[model samples]
Target chain A: MHAQDSSTGSLIAHTESPWRLFWQLLQRDRLAMAGLGILLALAVVALLGKATTEWLVIFDPTTVRLVDKFRAPLSEASALLPDADRPLTGVYLLGTDELGRDVFARMLQGSFVSMSIGFVAVGISIAVGVVLGGIAGYYGEVRIGPVTVDTLIMRFTDAMLCIPIFFLILVVVALLPASIYNIMIVIGLTRWMGISRFVRAEFLSLREQDFVLAARALGLPAYRIIFWHMMPNAMAPVLVTATIGVATAILTESALSFLGFGVQPPFATWGNILADGKNFIFDAPWLFFIPGFAIFVIVLAFNLLGEGMREALNPKLQRR
Target chain B: MSTAALLEVRDLAKHFALRRGLLGRPSGWIKAVDGVSFHVREGETLALVGESGCGKTTTGRAVLRLIEPSSGSVTFDGQELLKLNAGDLQRMRRDIQIVFQDPYSSLNPRMTVGNIVGEALRVHGIARGAELNERVAHILERVGLSPDFRHRYAHEFSGGQRQRVGIARALAMAPRFIVCDEAVSALDVSIQAQVINLLKDLQDEYRLAYLFITHDLNVVRHIAQRVAVMYLGRIVETAGTDELFDNPRHPYTRALLAANPLPDPSSPRPRALRGDVPSPLTPPPGCAFHPRCAEALAHCDRQTPTWIQIARRHGVACHLHQNTSRQGDDEIPDG
Candidate 1:
């Protein structure tokens, strides 16, 4: 009866209605919102770096100069550099790394690496896991195909789940030549199994519903039937899982780099810089403090955001 | 409409393993669908009515091979549907569709109405762009909705509208046979009427065949041309709608009729049927209904009654209905 209003007005669900609900939950979690804000700011810095700096300059983060090495932050001794390599001491306020690289520039470049990997990997994990789960849950009646697939998928997930992911990731990274792309793909591909199981459980419950039967009756094909229709209907719990997964992925990548397995040496990931500053902790505390705080805020932010989304998206919570 | 049988399920059976031995062999089977059979002629509505655990849903799913049966053959038109490959089976799906029970969780919230309906068209390569738009609009209209609904999400719609959208999505595929598996059971009474009426109108326009499975005899009575009453994975009685209701042959069917409390208090109501439905896994050795059948005799306890064809196109599974006089001396306490 409510959608009857579409007769008079627009076809889309009033965009404001759902967003308002999202806003209400998100706003209440001040910490999550703050984390969300910080990550967003970091993203903006990464995206707009070209506009912010005159030279699109060494977006190739790997280029290095050993001679201008380990220049301390804003110190007079390490201040000067010639034209081609010139970054003003005032301009490069965070100072340079061991390669005479501006730490701020490297940080901005590295933000792109860390966040994109975190997001893309999680996205892949969620997509693959959700599809597998949906099929296993929905087609419980079909004995032959799903039985083997479900077993393969679940056992694979079990293998991944039992192994310490950090240790496994290190071993995997070691086997391959260290690259940001490699880390992103490896993390994303391996992490989807748990989400798949969770999604399957949701689908198992949801497939018993009448509308789904109605959709089936209408002869919706398998792809649209499952992915477009059934999956979205059964997606809430998965969304919560995915949100938490993003934070977990970020933390994993950071930990890997810190242990000298991820992002590699001189690449200056948040983990690399934090590890770099550990030696200088007694001398200059700001280096460890800033990046350490960034990691803490982001992890906390994603966790809070995940919580808010869970409460917001969960139909059980909607009733209250 | 052309004269043809829309769908036919011959001796369909699906036995689910209840428990497996250490060697992975099934120790016992829950005979979920046991040699059940029925048909829907073109443009006719056939209802399969049974209490919960009666395999009505299973029968419906098995007919379309949604749940492949342990044994049996199903032919839609002249073609054998069970033999079709996955791709052909997918194409066959555009012909025989199903409507499920709960409206709330069926439609994908992320998909807009247009995509939901248009997907079937895309998969079958029926329409695209402007033609797809027009076809989608046409379908929305056929289901008593405006074309404007094309862009909306399921969450925006009410239970009834979502159900309509569910209907609209089905109709978009232009299917010949549909299994409405308790489609209206979850709706409010008013909404149920709307959906039922909509289904009727769409049936008339499309010349569709329906295998409507429901526990609600009232709905079956209103819509079914023929009705089959199922019990414990077996259909015990089947006849034309009026004949089955007026002269229900099986004790289970009689109990089902007795259990349905009519709204009018003035009408005589029979005594309530007692005892739970017997488990499908470990059913009574003789008659599956004998554990609770008041008319069960010593003979009833020793042998399972075969489906006897009585009246024209009518069948029943009870020894009591074998002759002019009832077999058992005991009478049901109707007071």
Candidate 2:
């Protein structure tokens, strides 16, 4: 907030951008800061895993040692390697699965798959939603060359909204290849309706704002007014929505993988890791807890960040 | 200042369609600006004075094509504004601009003061880079704001400062005519005076013509050389400012003049007009002001009074001043 100088009776320039102010406000929110810390750590680990997966990982997550299958954890791995001739190279930090693979290395690798799908799917969805929604909102009923546009786009959006998004994703995955890329594309396509509706609502309200009229009165082209003048102001809510949408996309991917319709084996996502742990839920509960806990933390971090951002950007809610 | 009018509007009318019920069929129309005709000569201010919902602001917007007129001709320097193609009309917008009423909403919050003013320049391709910044700073200074304030966003400025920025933005286009649509109505009285004075100074400097739309009669008396009083959607009376103030011919004009607050404590407060302004949605069959007009005759309820010339450059649309043959139905009688 800017304050007037009493001494000189002049306006002191406090030209801090809203994002900068939002950051300053967010710094005070301890829970959100904790979320931010967790998110940053996860992102760093994911990036490192992506870069050094072949070189740095001690164990190949797929390598199955039937003799060492279902090893308990660190204690069992060391006990199995007791003598001087014992093989210590295949030690599993987080124990072996039914197929005798390292859970710890798999978890690290799973972060890469889960987080990438989350971000890329969200990015694709935001792009599609913002463009389509902006068009529908700005020009309620417009003609492009010959065909009327707004009705077609909005009716399509409405039709898309009528279907359950998860069901739609399931159908898409069933039709196409069930690879990570296909899952991401399907999630991106299905999940964009929420963001599109949000962007459209923002644009509809912003379209009538005096600044938009002022831009028109200044003889700016319609595109300039819509994209440059109105869209920037409308981005605050879109940004908040996108942040939360990332969490949803991640959760959706995990659920799909758990259903065996997402990323297949050889690739380790949190969902597949959870799927692997389902058989051992009672005996070796660590498999279920590890991946489930990771999903919960990632989603919680994004949600907290999104809520803090909403409060920070909103002028009425900015007060301590 | 030249005698040639910079902007002229003839038979300007804007009717908004009201869509009632679920099917959204047009039920009726709100005649916001019906058959309004006026012109402002260079370096002169023509104030459109009316109460709320009297269509003064609508008239201003209609002239600029911000709200497209239902029917009429808007000629700026003999150019047929409505007839021009989109590109040509946009280009012509450089010469004809408007300053809106609300300061807060008028300026884009995302843009700094410099960009707000420079947008007009840049859009018109008048300047860019160092020249654009220099022009913006210069205009800011001219509007009584510091050049350093250019970096500040719209929210940082007070209402007065924002209004100044609005003025600077309009001036940046170097427009010959500007429609100040209640530009000073939202400001403090002291700030209003300063802005009015600034407008007068700018007019003198640029030889600018202004179509000032406002409900403030006193501000009009100070700033406007001529006045047009609107009732519902029609101009009830128009004359030179002093003449309209002293010998207001129409009942509505008299009521408006009487409503002006007197500063002198010795003077008694004049009686306000009875009844509310009739809705433009369903304007009274004949005279829109008859329901509220103190001097409304029985004939006023039956016939819409045509413009009757009362004196040199003075006209009133009322039966009380029926002293001449009606100005012909099709012809616009004023310059």
Candidate 3:
């Protein structure tokens, strides 16, 4: 009996860590695994692109060479290349654009830009969402002066939601100088309402949970109770929202750049690359197709990963 | 028991206001805990026994000010708790801690057991670093858990072990009073015995006063020095545990005691109390339990019963006991 009990105990200990359990659950989903694999590859590509462009200077995406223009995929760059440029130049793997820029080099840089924008925008949104939502849910019906914090914050969120977000982004980006930072900040600020609403809903229920009550009973200060105790428990939905939000932010940046408002020229972005290639759709299908396919795969991968996380985190759907 | 009470709650009430419509206008109040008055002396256990929705948990929370009381007073060691400022109240919480009902949800799942137990010590600025770890291990040992168990998370432990972790958390505060709010209600019957004994032993060691809130009559008889029986939102009777068990006063108290199942199959089951507990949102007039009280008087439907002392440390709130009162009647005022 003791031996059996010990074995069961060990089994339980093995699966006890929540993150391990979540990973185990996530590994069971094939689509999520595929998405994860794709994301990992993209991340490596983005990192290498960043290193080469910023520090290594191995790939220059902006060098104009009219001779290399409209080179088909898998074809070598002009054979008349000088020895100095020989080491740096390569075959147009995904073909060249109208500006004679190597599409491959531009794409590598674009990957980094897109990935950073996705992460930074979502980071800003998550920060704003968690704080506002926590305050709204924890201090529900608490009046600061004229109105309850819940009502005031929720009403403002609702007002923000009513605005067509893309158009709002368009208008804001139009007024401001087209800097990458401004686009990230604008998208982050505009897109936080959904995340805040999710966090508020989670907190509304979690605030009534016994652990929260126990925390309060222990005399934890309000901030400690909210951030330290409650926030960790309320983070599952927030994480799923964030995972999907990254996809949306990437899409938004891409759309903005496609419309000539994204990260300006000299800085390669998937959206601007696609925009630059739209004019040559018939002559050089690789330019438009490559960037478009990359965007499609990335957004789809994020969505899949987010869905997997949601299913894994849900207690009711747990297999064990 | 000592004459000086360590924790005293007087006319404590917690009325949740029901709001409706978009504008959120106050519709009415659900008086979950209305006019509850009780006290626990040093090293004594005052078990607040009641049915599920009788406001026993509410009363316990109000005493600790976990759920802020809508009205009334909670005094701990001569200090008015309800009147203390946020900072002072937080400081005062060092002497008052609580053990929640559901062991599963009581401990923070994301925190390791050591962090959970040592949190109070850190929060109160009582200990830090090595001292905090030592204290947490000691407290866990005191609660009958292996000191090494502190390294694990709450989910890794069984229900009984998790409960010990919860106790260790409360014990870490070195609290004078701890509200065990149905602390053992969710554990198995065998585990319940072990936890109750641990609580008793801890009380002896620390001179801790407990407002043990539960509906388990058998458990109450085993641990509580005093028992307060509640029906709906009010305490119907309060007496010495043995006295209340041997000779229960008030129809609600009698019904509750009679409802406890016996060990022998041959023993006939007492008639169960009829109807559900009246909704606290719209409680029946006069006695809250009148609709279900078998021996309810005609006046019980029209006039609220006054709490009267029938014997020393024994009080009953029923019109039947009103005439036999030895002291002046203490009418429980509505909140």
Q: What's the chain B TM-score of candidate 1? A: 0.92
Clashing pairs in 3: none
All candidates' lDDT scores?
0.74, 0.82, 0.85
Between candidates 1 and 3, the one scoring higher on lDDT is: 3
> Model 1, B59: alpha-carbon shift in Å?
1.1
TM-score winner, 1 or 3: 3
Q: Give the TM-score of candidate 1.
A: 0.83
Candidate achieving the largest TM-score: 3
Per-candidate interface C-alpha RMSD? Answer: 5.0, 5.9, 4.8
lDDT measured at residue B83 in model 1 versus the true structure, 0 to 100: 90
Per-residue CA lDDT of candidate 1, range B183-237, in tens? 8998887778778888888899888889999999888888888888888887788
lDDT string for model 3 (B151-248, tens) is 77788777887888888888888898999999999988878888888899898999899999998999998999888888878888988888898888
Evaluate candidate 2 by giving its C-alpha RMSD to the native, one decimal. Answer: 3.3
DockQ of 1: 0.34
lDDT of 2 by residue, A198-303 (tens): 7888888887677787777788998888878888888888888888888998899889888988899989999999987988998888888889999999999999
Give the winner by DockQ: 1 or 2. 2
Weakest 10 consecutive residues, lDDT, candidate 2 chain B?
B325-334
Over all chains combined, what TM-score does candidate 3 have? 0.94
Q: How high is the TM-score of chain A in each model?
A: 0.82, 0.88, 0.94
